[model samples]
Target: MPLKTVNVGLIQQACGADRNTNLAESINGIRELAEHGAELIVLPELHAHSYFCQLEDPTSFNLAEPIPGPTTDALGAIARELGVVIVASVFERRAAGLYHNTAVVLERDGHIAGTYRKMHIPDHPGYYEKYHFTPGDLGFTPIDTSVGRLGVLASWDQWFPEAARLMALAGADLLLYPTAIGWNPDDEEEERQRQWEAWIIAQRAHAIANGIPVVVCNRVGSEDDPSGQTPGISFWGTSFIVGPQGEWLGTASAEEPATLVAEVDLSRSEEVRQAWPYLRDRRIDAYAGLLKRYLDR
Candidate 1:
């Protein structure tokens, strides 16, 4: 299964405090992307609601919605109408006492393709995600979609190359991340630039290493914590699409809300992999340190 190019649509936008407004804006953006020749559209993490990680409140759990509930139904409808595949981040209410930060894929035919829960749930500082989401039990896997096998992961999961490798092993052609990451508004300019650059570099490296295209869609704008206890995160928009060899195809601005599109050729993946041969090497037999939490023994 060679993917030479993949057309990617990244929706970067400033999130509002209102959930309905955010979802509506996302829908409109998806429509616009489709109109502009985007076969697949990806939205930022927790786009339907404010990045609730800003605070730890029991009431915040109320934002979780059932997977096949209203949200999916609406998304499925949109996928069908636009005839485009969609990757959307969601706060999933798995059961009465279980929840996960999940990425849902809607195939072009309007059916629920598959889903990947967020594997790395960060619970540090302003990003208090573990309070709201259970770590993904499904492991690293790609969803089968009409456009392609989507290697969809959540915000924190993007940092790990192991996650991307597992998806590539599962025959993913495109890596999709629905992310909401930002710096503490008080950070020095240098620190902010470093964080943003590191993010883009890490994902592009994944594409180069795995011989697959990477699409990262992030939320823009600033959010203030309702608790007033901490300065909220200032989300760096900069949504991007990078080629298999770490080449930049297109990128959104730092603060603008836009539906960014880039055409991809899905047939080049096999070519790149053949030339690089990174995956075919035999380090698998000796590298067992990855399984341990730490090499404390």
Candidate 2:
């Protein structure tokens, strides 16, 4: 079969308190990438505002909005104008007290393609997402678009191999992560480096295991904590694109705002999977243990 290539772009941006400014920066990045022939563009997680999950105040919930609300309206307009598929993350306000970390996909014609709420919610010192977002109800499913089937997941979801595997089994062509992960400012340099390396390795391992390309977009720069109890988080922005063979196609800077476009050959996954054949030899019957929390004797 012939090569099925899609030019993918990732925007690595630093958000501030001003939502307008942050959204404008994302829009500029999208326009720039579209001009350079990017058919599909992805933004970082919660790109519209600062990382406000640092505190568990009820006021922070005001930042959440409906899915077809303002942010998507603006991004959809751009996607329609440029005729490119755009994957964006949003803090979805489902109801009065229900919220979710949702990843929204816009088709080329400016329509809502699909959405994937982040299933895994992390609660740590600097990153306190569980306090803000409810667990995602949508199962591991891929959003269909003109380019291909995109398995879009949020920051915490990237760490789970089961999530990636389920998406691959459901006919996903590429696994995309809209991430907002970073290091604690108080941690030692060595520890920080280990964390960063582990993050990258885990995602790349998912690619190698599933025989699908992995695209991740992360934020850059530091955002202060509201309570001032801790130093704050310094988002290490090493956004990257890797092939089905876990080979780096392109990578952005570790501490700067960047726009990267890489041509992903969708057809290559078939060849890689055929040679590796990891999926073919799987023992599905014995995998019931995975469903349980743990194998306690």
Predicted structure with the largest lDDT when compared to the true one: 2
Q: lDDT by residue for model 2 over 1-297, one digit each (tens)?
A: 899999999999999999999999999999999999999999999999999998788998999999899999999999999999999999999999999999999999999999999999999887788999999999999999999999998899999999999999999999999999998899999999999999999999999999999999999999999899999899999999999999999999999999999999999999999999999999998999999999999
Which residue pairs clash in candidate 2? none
Please give the RMSD to the true structure for each candidate, in Å.
1.5, 0.6
TM per model?
0.96, 0.99
Q: Whose TM-score is greatest here?
A: 2
How much is 209 displaced in model 2, in angstroms?
0.1
The clash number for model 2 is 0
- Candidate 2 segments whose C-alpha is farther than 4 A from its true place: none
Candidate 1 has an lDDT of 0.88
